[model samples]
Target: MELRDIDLNLLVVFNELLHQGRVSAAARTLGMSQPAVSNALSRLRKLLGDDVFLNTSKGMVPTPLSERLAEPIAFALGTIHDTLNSKAEFDPATSARNFTVAMTDIGEISFLPALMKRLSEVAPGVTLSTVRNTAVNLREEMENARTDLAIGFLPDLQTGFFQRRLFSQRYVCLFRKGHPLAEQGITLKSFCAAEHVAIVAAGTGHGMVDESIQRAGITRKVRLQVPHFVAVGHILQTTDLIAVVPEAYAKRTLEPFDLETAVCPVKIPQIVINMLWHGRHHREPGNQWLRQTVFEEFSS
Candidate 1:
């Protein structure tokens, strides 16, 4: 294949197809029709003399050649975009860019409101959307620019991702304002005896607090299990069950329900919350502004 035969636009389509894994989705992302993307893929195949992607039951699965080409193509495209955009000033006050973030339910409660308020004051036209930071597809979403930022306790993000620590939080037990445990500070014995509500944030039955207890050879009677921290307040306010939650989140959410917070009886590691982004957007002006805004708000 000769350089003259390659269309730079075809490379763009190929990169999008690699990220999207389907011609239709790639078309949607590229603002092109499905047939246009398909034709571009065909052109790419002829130029490279390789069947770059194979249609599979699971969508477009890239061949070995396509897989090898993906990283360099994506990097070159990102560099071109960043180099061009970096010359333009990022005026947050007037720009109407939309940013997508991924975080757990706890992040929605603790961070979103304040971030929105700040954005409203600083960049009134800017908008934001939040999605769950499920363990399964976070890396792919970030790599593909589907999620602009992810803020949470993500210890699983690997290479090609950058992170900044927002804050460190420890476990706190939350209960109703007048719960018996609140009257006389909680002890390990009382904590173990009480019926607790465990939050399985990652769909795992055990969390950091549970692991701590297990390490100490102690066990607590978990009377209820919840998948989100938002439900814990309501359950604790109405029942005798207590919940172990992040200190920052509990401080913000528990107050509305007239709840009280106490330090966890078991020793658990401090949860370090971080804001993560992909290297692809590291130098892009809009993404830089967003990252700076978040850092100023949460890192302080």
Candidate 2:
């Protein structure tokens, strides 16, 4: 609006006049009448108390004051124009963008290590952060750009979202290598008889596992229930309890906890993990790259 309490428009006229170097020429370039240009120059002279230009035999010559201010004014105007016109896309190697992805703890265990390793190799300056996918405001957060992407089985994020299927996860039973089931092998009867720890991932995509178990009419000896997969491996390793988990997640924990996985005896729903983002981010360069990274890393 104003520059140092002077009208910004006057500086525009001044810059054009400095370039054109004649009142009539500057007037035609600015789409203004010669009289209007003279009025603006008169006002600028009064404001700056300088004869900014001199009518010479050759042309309108810039005064010493005009020469002194020329470079900075040109630089400022050129910088603003370049910034407004720029369409530069994200460059991962040079970008310092911090992106947020929402996922379950299982998604974290199954996805983060490889993802981080790849990021370190290609996009070392880019950073990542995570939030629980089950958080109440997840959809709102994604729409608002606070959450950049989501990974896991998120059926509720259907409307106003774009998703790519990464893989379908089959259920498996995990137990410590020393557990009796490791020797006995899992059978329908043995599976139903064992003390089990169920992941109470209520009302989300993974909850379909429990819902399928219920609908199948196979009554398991339920010993404990937990809300997340973070401690399932350690809990089962220290106890006789066996927990049903995604096959990938079970395998990931197996060696670390000295656990063994047996084929789930009953038919339960297969969870389809997907990469999801708000429709708003469908064309954003950074979001596209991040989605591609997830698809490339975990997609089956």
C-alpha TM-scores of all predictions = 0.71, 0.76
Candidate 1: segments with Cα more than 4 A from true spot: 1-86, 203-206
- RMSD, every candidate, angstroms: 15.9, 4.3
Count clashes in each candidate, considering only residues at least 3 apart in sequence or on different chains: 0, 0
After superposing all C-alphas onto the true structure, candidate 1 shows an RMSD in angstroms of 15.9
Q: What is candidate 2's CA lDDT for residue 105?
A: 87
Q: Candidate 1, residues 60-164: lDDT per residue as tens digits?
A: 999999889999999999998999787756899998888999988888998989999999999999999888887548889999998999888887886999999
The TM-score, computed over Cα atoms with residue i paired to residue i, of candidate 2 is 0.76
- Regions of candidate 2 where Cα sits further than 4 Å from its true position: 1-77
